[model samples]
Target: MTTAVAAPFRFFSLRVVRTRRLGPSLVRVTFAGADLAHFHSHGHDQSLSLFLPAQGRTEPVVPIELGDGWWQGWRELPDDVRAVMRSYTLRALRRNPDEIDIDFALHGIGPGAATPPGPASRWAARARAGDPVVLLGPAVADNRAIRFRPPEDTDLVLVWGDETAVPAATAILEALPAGTRARAWLEVPHAGDVQDVAAGPDVEITWLTGGRGALAEIRAARLPRCERPYVWIAGESGRVRELRRHFVQERGTDRRRVTFVGYWRRGLTEEQLRAAGE
Candidate 1:
């Protein structure tokens, strides 16, 4: 078996300063602490790992010394005592206040209300000012989690995702160079989940509301003609793979120009999914 290499990211103990409902099924959590000054966000589709406190706990249990052995150390912790880890995208980063904003989709409050709470979602829903959590993030701005990289000569950008991918898509949109052409399709749980997106004047966003199959909709929708269109997609694993196929096969787009991320699977928990990959 090939052991996964330990990540070089730094760990920070951040406290939730505030939380607010961004839309029907989105919560924006603002975290701040002295350690945030070391956090460097690359801006586009940047992902972070949050080590959340276990259920009924107030503070996350994290290692005091984190380095090459951190991954093994965390894995060796007893199951019941280990903090729950989850990945999230950075929505916004502010330097003056030394804060980072993360948006969480309220997966527990809607159609899946009766389902057991996901560790991260549950923590985010109940998160309040002063609540502490530990984050594994970048000390340098160019760390690898920011995956939305379009080629320099690309003519246009195509973006798509479900609610879980919205923050990243929006961030990618906002980070585009001024006047760059782009089109995005965001799938949310409801119409109310749509928020104002900041993008260049040439960018257009289409929000896909309830029951709209994002992959099917994108397949049938008319895309603006472009000689070199870079595509970025993230969401359910199956759909993302299918979308990737469509872009590279049916659409005949260059394989290198399309980036697809399977953020989650429908029936599997994040831990299960990660184990399958390992």
Candidate 2:
């Protein structure tokens, strides 16, 4: 059921090949399909839209045959029958076998959770081999979905992300060229959630366990003096907004040099956030 939607983006039918628990709060799901032979991306913070099967269904219901009109057609499906679509970032892409890895942050799925697990979380937690899904992703190597672009003249790279953004943040670090000067702050809910990253010698990474908030810690720390520093931050919407303000207003960094994405809001689901045009 693969179909071309537009240039550089299309729908691909895929199935889960395996799932691994990265930590108490994360699960890594690997998917594969013949359509993946056409899937390509530069891979730094590459965004993806995943369509999951409705509860108790084995396959997702995506109207890929409609091509450009698939969105409208999908929306017209019954609420309980339509596939559940969620935004995720590409963690890793592989060839030969044609596979992609997506890391899921299991929000509210653990012990003593304050909230109930969402559909995505519940699905990822229970996903097994051969579970059918569909992905809307890039068909070209250098697509616009990647948001980790830094100016050529940049002297230093600054990165920050919470658990939800770990996969993207880590991918960006791994893709940095040798000798690139970079510093990163990755915040996770539990100490066990910190995974080892293979960054260049010049890249310094600090794993922040739940503690003083990211904004407070970042403000208290001193960054190396660099004339052209580029910043990338992603996490909750309210925190992302505050971090952007800190860099642009407080640190005097050029607004154009900073990239920030709010992966989620405190109280809003993806549907609600999109409806409000966030």
Candidate 3:
């Protein structure tokens, strides 16, 4: 059920141990597995690939037995039979029980939905204890997948993320040292989607919901003066690009000091975005 995919990254057969509703539009699913004994991560914005069971299946179907060829094998499977893969952030990692928490951003999942829920959203909304899944995750700490790296001379940290990036942004904020000065903007669909983040007083968090967009709010506010500020932004592709430009070209921040990741696009599914190499 588990197989090594590459150095520092491998497949782990896991099952949902519990689920909690973090907000109106977010759910936290905790997963555990014996395979987690080898799992390791530095935790700040750690990226993970989760494989959910295909429709009408009890467990995910990933051709891990093919070893290094599993990617091609899985991709070749019929759409209805292949496992649904989605990228997620490591919200929290726990010891002793070898469990990891992944926060899901629900969309079109409940009653009165305006659009059909995607495979991942549907699965997470109904996920139950003992539901089987698989994860392609890190086996070594400090892996490249953790992308919120600030330079040693960083004096201030700026973060912006939509609901999709909330987990990563919160994790980054919580991981900051005591004296770190950080400001964050988290945007969600509904006011009920805003959740409490435990961070030091030096970290100021702004929650945007049902109103102004992140770019507009950020542009209207004045940032604290700092010689070297590291900016991390993630959300819709177009929005992320615009924010990156604002920081690099308008704000005069060094391009290297800004880390921007597009968690999703406005009108594209993750698969489509990947296929287009976005």
- Candidate 2: clashing pairs of residues: none
> Which TM-score value belongs to model 3?
0.97
What total of clashing residue pairs does each candidate reach? Answer: 0, 0, 0
Collision pairs in model 1: none
Report the C-alpha lDDT of model 3 over 1-278, residue by residue, as the tens digit: 57799988999999999999987789999999999999999868999999999998887999999989999999999988999999999999999989999999988874345788898999999999999999999999989898898999999999999989999999999889999999999988888888888899999999998756877888887988899999999978888999999989889999999999988988789889889987
Please, what are the lDDT tens digits per residue for candidate 1 over residues 1-278?
11223444678888899998877778999999998877776757888988888766666776647556767788888777788988899999998889999999878775535566687777788889999888888877887887888999999899988899998999899889997899888999878889898788999998998768776777787887789999999988888888899999999999999999988999888899888982
Clashes of 1: 0
The global C-alpha lDDT for each of the candidates, from Candidate 1 onward, is: 0.84, 0.92, 0.91
Ten contiguous residues minimizing lDDT sum, candidate 2? 209-218
Better of 2 and 3 by lDDT: 2
lDDT for model 1, please. Answer: 0.84
Give candidate 2 regions above 4 Å deviation: none
Best by lDDT: 2
